[model samples]
Target: MTVTFSYRSRQTWADPWDDYRALRDEDPVHEVGDGQFWVLSRFDDVFAAARDTATYSSANGLTTAPDDMAGFDEKARPIVMMDPPDHTAMRRLVSRPMTPRQVAPVEDLVREFVTDKLDAVADAGEADIVEALFKPLPSFLVAHYLGVPTEDRVLFDRWTERIVQATAESAAQDGPNQQAFLELFEYAGGLIERRKADPGDDLVSGLVQQGEDVASAMWIVGFIFTMITGGNDTVTGMLSGSAVLLDRHRDQRRLLIDDPTAIPNAVEELLRLTSPVQNLARTVTRDVTLHGTTIPAGKKVLLLFASANRDEREFGPTAGQLDVKRRIERIVALGYGAHHCLGASVARLQCRVALEELLGRFPDYSVDESTARFAAGWSTRRYEYLPLTTN
Candidate 1:
């Protein structure tokens, strides 16, 4: 059967949400077009498929891996792609760094990183938040946390941009990024070996303590690239998106200024509503039925997490409202179940700290809509650059 990928043709940012909404009301699970795959847009359907690894597979790789990542598949050929026992075993190596007990101690580091980045722009008063603020926080933190030298921070920042190249122009413009990745990989591989010899008090040291060998060593390097790409770009998007949303919702901005405690929950609400990574693909290995549609194996299904976040069936009437107080757990934007984001806590902390400092330093910031840009891919959406001005 010839698969007619509707999502790819005549694309628009809203097309995914629009199609999902239409599916939820009319045919929640049906063939979208001739020879096309089935879509499951409702909350229960997407999560059920995501949780059930028996049918859906992450092995052929999540198609959302950006095109610019040169050896990304070979590099990412680690736990992120693994399903069962393999995924479980490898995930255990660095699990402690992300839990609450582990993360709390890093709060000071988070604040320090936030302070320094914000300080870079506090004097300018008018800087592109993506370039001046959002871009560096994770770049700095990722390098710092991974034991990469401070001097290499600039190189890390550039390589991450290339690996995350989402638009046609940026993709075309990533020749330098490709070269940088080769140099960075060799440099990082050597760094990984150095950590093996004399492990220190850093996250990479912890990986070494876990008996990380050459394979695990490679995974660690790949993880850094993946984490920076995923954690950095997504957080940057959320921060940028929140800046824009707050600009539109002046009253919401007031609420934040009045009560800074709302910031944490506000982060979750923003994460749910913004939905940076739109959908992830899973190819079926065995014949199975999902959301009332049968897959005869060897077909890919997109778990539209962005659509599932707004699943009216689960959220009731206020599903779409942006309520800072509202708790939005069970979001798949970070992936759900066993394969859920291992770095979720770090990502949350990054977003929280980044925004907190932004607000504290410049409680009065406005988004310049004319200068904002969005990631090009229909599958994984993020901000290209979010320009803001402080008044």
Candidate 2:
């Protein structure tokens, strides 16, 4: 049986497990658009391809859409679209501040932020957690790092929404939201210039001082774009989606409430189970054969991180089920290999702190399923609104 799947399909966005399972079992190397691209659904296959950066290049772009889809100039290249040495150097420029040790000092700050959010809704007993808590916390944190003033922080959310809309389609045939891309691009450049004259302890200031090259400035703008969109949405989705998951899986919720220490492992498990950034596209550098299929050179391949996270071969028979205590040896939820998420340590820290405060304060919290609404995007899972009751 042949299984048809496209990242843009609404059915794929709503529920893709059955199709993922079919593709994994019957056709691990599934092709779409004849020779346009391929989807790797198995854990091993996806991991291997991610590790072999030379064979599966990222130079073309991560999304299946054309390189120019986002309306950036030909010279504009985000770190996500580069490979190896250049990618390494670009990532290193800002990687220090995001490392686990560096972000550790900010735990108190994060907890304070989380505590304040929970306090606002503590008495109400009911609130849209997505809008009230999960959404704003990450936006605030990202803004804090980027040195964007509180008044201008709302722009990040607005910019992120438009970017998501641009890539919501399979091809982005009409081209990406040009206005949003240009608005964000120009905003980042302005911010960098400001930081250069008046250096601060923020990430942007640190980056500006590190370089004076035209290319570096271009990459910085692109990197900021990546951070605003990927950084904000990934954490928001994890928290909002996990809230719904824990509500459905009371047993797991109980485990967390009973032992707060279990929240860290539970965060990893939740990420593996509910991967927010479902799949990322990579262009094949040369012909590569997996199973019985021969994917020719210069084609695109999507590493199905969400599907691979649930592979039975890697996680055993209960792969599809949620296990708060499940020991995850290796999961591609935040991606794998050379392109692993640079802000991963920071993301984990926020999710861990947020869940700790949330479950500790409202152990019996429940999600109001009827009012829950998810954003219309297939690339990354996002919640428009999620109502919750501290029952």
Candidate 3:
């Protein structure tokens, strides 16, 4: 079980499609590191594992949980950490507010927000997209949805990023987002207490009166934080990555400019290639063999989705090429099966609307590649800094 640290491994882990294509062609599952777990590289294997929670299991934590949590506590298991009846109940209760349809009314506000940010940029100058738009846009939106106060929005974003960064650090090492959870619980708990006394239209108020216990409502808040953690980075990544790719493929950029309908397809291809959340892991509840490799019970197995999306076996030759016309349905980017991203539809809607509005307002855009900053963390991959120029 020797792991090869190729010059390309750095890029592959950061941008993993190439390694996945090669692995899917050769051996789909390989033991890496100290043989702690097996890496699942093919699309089917990853998809099956994500969908079939009974055999593959979820308590192991998606991607990876902090080492401290595996020892366990009762509420330590988030909805993503459960299976069957419990998972179904929890996810159903909280996910309603985040659905694409539920979030539709806010779409116009989103377009305005994106346009205003784009307008702030000079015609041919540099600006950090992450700071200027990517980080704040979704952050503010989620805050607004949760009824987080105007003064507290920045606080909410910063605290959550710290938790995510800490989770990333743990992966490199040992974490829930516990601190953020507690702060939010305290806040949501207070709000719930207040809402119990006086209710409203916000999601939190609905949960307090008729939802599960406060703990259930608490996890709903946690669930939203998870959505924010799981989503915010990638949306920014796709926008930043698409902006860069469009700049590099000037011809494609021209095509998209000429036909606004092309923006949606371009967003899909961008998602397939630049998977922001790079890895997903499942714990084995029983013995299961994938492509002839056995995964033992209780051990964690990781799905390298960032690797699988471009696997030549799955996409055939030219799997690596970016085709805007490619249909991204069923790709591992939003995941598959029951636990697939609850926010997938909302994300796509937001992205489609965002890109269309962006291009409509300013037809041509370019990223200053030299100053581009790729986000670092084994748990996630995205652009932390992408400066842009528009015409």
Candidate 4:
């Protein structure tokens, strides 16, 4: 049986597991788009491709979309697009402020933010989880984490949303995408300058203090852009997706409510199941053969992290089921290798707190699947709106 894989297919997101199961079992190295690129669905294959950065280079770009895709320029691309020494340097500089120790202090703030957001809708009986909780909580927390001024968080949120929307679809050519990029550059540049003049104990200030050249400043802006764009949407998707999943899997949700300590593991399980950033593209530096299929050099390979996370070979027979109690030794939801998500810890912290607070307040809450809407785009999966009934 030949399985056709197209990231843009609505049915792909509507029922991705069926598609992924077919890919993994029938064609691990499935070619799509008349050989425009290759898609890797099996767990071991995706893991190898991600870890073998030498052969699967990120230097060209990470999306299966053509090189002409919007915002594909080297200078504007996120650190995820870079490989080797450059990636190492930028990742090192950006990782400092996001270390576990640094992110630990923000847990209190996350709790407060989650509580306040949840409290606002507690009396309403029903509210759109995406609007009231998922969207604002991450946007505000990421802004706080980035040290953006309280007065400017709204603009920061707007800028991040614009950039995410602009890049979510490869074929998108929206003018606002470029406009948002320029505006964010200008804004981040000003912040960088201010931090340089008077360094503070914030991430931006840390980036400024570590810089010794103009290129460092450019990286500073890049880091900020990456943080805002990377940090916000993924978490938003994770939280909203969690709500929908938990609603469907009441028994698993009960496990978290009964044992709060399970929240941490639940967070990981949710990340695995949701795999918010569905797939990322990598450029093959050399011809490589996998699972008896050879992808030529300079070709684009799409690593389906979402599919890999559910591979039966890795997660056992129940890979497709939601088992919060199932111990997963490792998950590739955050990507693997040199470009692993720098904010993974922060995202976990936020999700744990969000779940604790949300489940505690609305233990009996349920999702209105009839009205729920999910944003389109295989690159990143997120809920546009998730209405919840508190009763």
Candidate 5:
């Protein structure tokens, strides 16, 4: 029997777990688009593909382009798409200030931000988590980390929204996506110039001090884009997803509330279950065979991290179930291998701090699923609006 699958369909985004489970069980390396590409659903295959950068290259791009943009070349697409030597060099340059030690100082700031946001919504009996908390918190943090002025933080949010919208089907032909990219590039360029004149103690300043060549400047801009966009989207989704998950699973919420120390473990479990980053696309560097399927060279392979995270084969029979107490060593939620999320530490820190504050302040809060809406047709699962009521 043959089954069909598509990552672009609205139904898939609405509820992807069912399709992912089917693919993992029946066709681990299922071909899609008439074998134009392959999707890997098994945990082992996804992990191996991520690590085996040699065979599965990111040089082409980290996402499968829409049919309209099929001819797009992303070889020079910054840190996410660069392969080996170049990728290593760029990643090292960007990782200096992002290390856990460097990012440690931001925890207090994150706490303060989370506290202020939650406090503002405290008086109100209800709030949209996306607008009121999850969205602003990460945008502010990303701005602070990137050295964007507080005054211009609003612009960052605007650009982020436009960019994110561009990923949706409705905005596929919209000009805002390109406009946002250009605007962001101009903003980063101006910031780089300022950093060059009077270096500050921030990530942008660090990049400026690195060098002032065309290539160096472009790389810096790309890094800035990656940090800002990647930081905001994934963190937002995870936080929103956590709220919804906990609201649904009061039992797990009780566990975390009773023992605040369990928040960290619960964060991992939430990441596994939510898996905000549903899938990432990689170019086939060479012909590779997996699960008796041969994917020819120069093809695109979609690594379904979301599926792998819930694979019963790897996470046991209860993989479909969310157990905050479940003891699991590691997960590919943040990704795996050479291109694992560079901001994983910061993201985890933000999520942990946000969850702690959220649970402490609104222990009895509940989400109104009827009022909830999720973004569609993109690699990341994010909330456009998530309404909640607090007692």
Candidate 6:
């Protein structure tokens, strides 16, 4: 038996869990599109490849789509597309502000955002979770964190969504969105210039001061774009996906509602289940053999984090099932090693705070599955809109 998969296919994105299981069981190291790329679906294999950055490089591009992979000088690529010393240096420029300790204070602001949104829906007892809470909360927090002016937050939100959609379109092989890219780059440049002169207590200002000479102006703009897209998009997926998961798995929801301290760990379980970032492509630096397949050098290899998270070898027989209390020793949901997501702490903080507030307030809330619509994306699987009824 053989399982075929391609990131460019809508069917693959529609539902990949079943195909992932087949690939893991039959061919852990599977090829797609006549050697377009190789996929590593097993937990151990994906984990090893992600950590071994030297062998599996991110310098070429992080996305699998050929169209999206073009037109970027290696030197000026986003931090996600850089490896080691350069990636290390670029990441350090803004790491301090995103650390767990640094983001602790941001939790209060997150709680406020969640509380306010949930409050608006209290009277109606029904609202689209994505629209009411999940969507705006992340954008608002990101705007505050980056020091974007309150008046310009609307523009920030619009730009982030456009960029994220453009990304999805590229992944689906729908042409690249040059307009969105240019618009965001221009906006980010303006913000960077403002930060340079004003120097506020925000991530952008910190990057300008620290990277004034160390990094190029374009890199700073790229960093800001990375932060904006990463902060807004992934967090929304995690929260909205968790809502759908919890709504389906009421037992787990009850557990979290019963014990709020368990929410943090539950967040991890949800991340693993949701697997917001489905997979990212890494350019292979050397010919690497895994599970009887020798993937040649200069090949694009995708580390299927979503499949690996549910791998039974590492997660036991109930890997496919949702178990919020399941003690997870390790999971590649956020990723691993040097390229691990920089905005991870901030994302976790936002999701944790959102869940704590949402569950506490509307424990009986049920998702109107008929109205639920998920994004048609390859890299990230998230809800476009999820209607909820508290009745």
Report the lDDT tens digits of candidate 5 across residue range 145-187: 7788878988988987776566544463567778887898898
Task: For candidate 6, write residues 1-391 as lDDT tens digits.
Answer: 8788876333345467898999899989998888888999999999998899999998878776555457776545799888898889878877888899999988778888789888989989999889898888878877887889989988778777777776665532334456657777788888889988899998788877876467677777777777766777688888888998899999989999999999999989999989888889998888998877899998899999999999999999999999988888888989899988888898899899888888889998899877678776667878878899876
The lDDT, on a scale of 0 to 1, for candidate 3 is: 0.68
- Flag clash pairs in model 5: none
Whichever of 1 and 6 has more lDDT, that candidate is: 6
Cα lDDT tens digits, model 2, 336-373, are 88888888888899889988998889989988877677
- What local lDDT score does residue 61 receive in model 5, on the 0 to 100 scale? 72
- How good is model 4 by TM-score? 0.95
The CA lDDT at 366 in model 3 is: 66
Separately for all candidates shown, the number of backbone clashes (residues 3 or more apart, or on different chains) is: 0, 0, 2, 1, 0, 0
Model 1: residues >4 Å from true position, as ranges? 1-11, 14-16, 30-33, 64-76, 166-174, 209-216
Compared with the true structure, model 6 gives a TM-score of: 0.94
Listed per candidate, the RMSD to the true structure in angstroms reads 3.8, 2.5, 3.5, 1.9, 2.2, 2.2
Scanning candidate 4 in windows of ten residues, the lowest lDDT window is 68-77
Clash pairs, candidate 1, are none
Model 1, span 1-391: residue lDDT tens: 2223344311355345566676667766556444245566778888888898867778666663323234555644656677887777777776777776788778888898778767767777787788877767766767777887778777777776776663322453366766766777787788878888888877777776676443477777776666666666666666777777777877877787789889998888888877776677777788777555676687667777877888877777777767777876577777788888887887788878877777777888887877676766645555666777777
**Where is model 1 poorest over a 10-residue stretch in terms of lDDT?**
1-10
Error of 4 at 244 (Å): 0.8
User: TM-scores for all candidates?
Assistant: 0.87, 0.93, 0.87, 0.95, 0.94, 0.94
Better of 2 and 6 by TM-score: 6
lDDT of 4 by residue, 131-167 (tens): 8978877788667766788888788888887877766
